[model samples]
Target: MISLQSGELFDTTIKDLLIPADKVAHVQLGNNLEHALLVLTKTGYTAVPVLDPHFTLHGLISSTHILDSILGLERIEFERLETMKVEEVMNTNIPRLNLNDQVMTGLNLVIDHPFVCVENDEAVFEGIFTRRAVLKQLDRRIKNK
Candidate 1:
């Protein structure tokens, strides 16, 4: 956990708790479902951020999304994974947070999501603010109080 002064707890920002982009596992928009699945499995994450060639936050891709896309009436179409692109199946209507967003703002958003993508003013991918991180901070604040 990132150490914080008791007084600073309520003033915490998303950037303070962010898992920086470089440290996060992600896939590019042009990436195939096969590659996205590999990344999700290797990182032990159900989902990961999707970016364009310039690293702008596009949306999110998940194992569930990949599986759903490849599902067929008769059976799972595993072969389709190699043919489908991430951009074709990613969830574009996702909640996002700015780097300067308050912890309370993140707390609200995380209630419905495991993690929220963070973006800079330029809409460039910064990182993610996770529900676990919010919970940890809340726990620390309670202990201090």
Candidate 2:
């Protein structure tokens, strides 16, 4: 069994477990709200990180947020949604982690959020620490043992 008697493996660096940004489908800050809805619909992802052209993590956009905004707008015109940008409705308070932070720093975050955004030392968005991905890694270790 891949047992860490003292739970020491949680100390593993997140860099070793992260779902690299390139492997994920992210939304751009300037992307239209309609585009956000489409991505969530197509990907079936509850939320997706919003990045700038330089891949800086700005916020997270979710289907719920898009739906809420549309309902609040009370407008049926698709053009309205097209005119609004992801930055306008994306959640800016989502949790963040350093690209090299220990996995322990991400465990608590995964308990609540679907994923935690990771950034490099330059504060550039690097990837996501997804709950499923983390669990999968742990499971793989156990199985291999």
Candidate 3:
């Protein structure tokens, strides 16, 4: 539960909510998943975006995906695994929130999507939102008491 003073709750814009570019953690598509795992573990991030050689957004991968591969119940082949590119893994039908969108709209998408890629209609990767970020914002509001 949250409570705030009248002026305390600033209508948070996406620009205000977005994890700034400097704060975003992302990986290149060519990078090995092993290295990606290392980064994820170090940063405590569940997933990260994969970018192309030209820095174009490709897709996202998560720790769960890696764990599924390692569990081997599916018995994936190395060649087939190699073909399992981030573009193939990431949710292409990404739900995004525009910079002008209301904070609650973004919060609704976050309920289902672990992270939503912030972008224009062209789907450029601007930044991402994690549960941590949202909670952090909420914590700020509570502390404003």
**Most accurate candidate by lDDT:** 1
lDDT tens digits, residue span 55-83, model 1: 89999999999999999999999999999
Runs in model 2 lying further than 4 Å from the true structure: 1-8, 72-77
Task: Report lDDT per candidate.
Answer: 0.91, 0.84, 0.65
Taking the tens digit of each residue's C-alpha lDDT, what string does model 2 give over 86-145?
A: 999899998899977888889889999878999999879889898997778678777877
**Model 2 steric clash pairs:** none
Clashing pairs in 3: none
Candidate 2 TM-score, C-alpha based:
0.88
Per-candidate total of colliding backbone pairs: 0, 0, 0
Stretches of model 3 off by over 4 angstroms after superposition: 1-10, 70-84
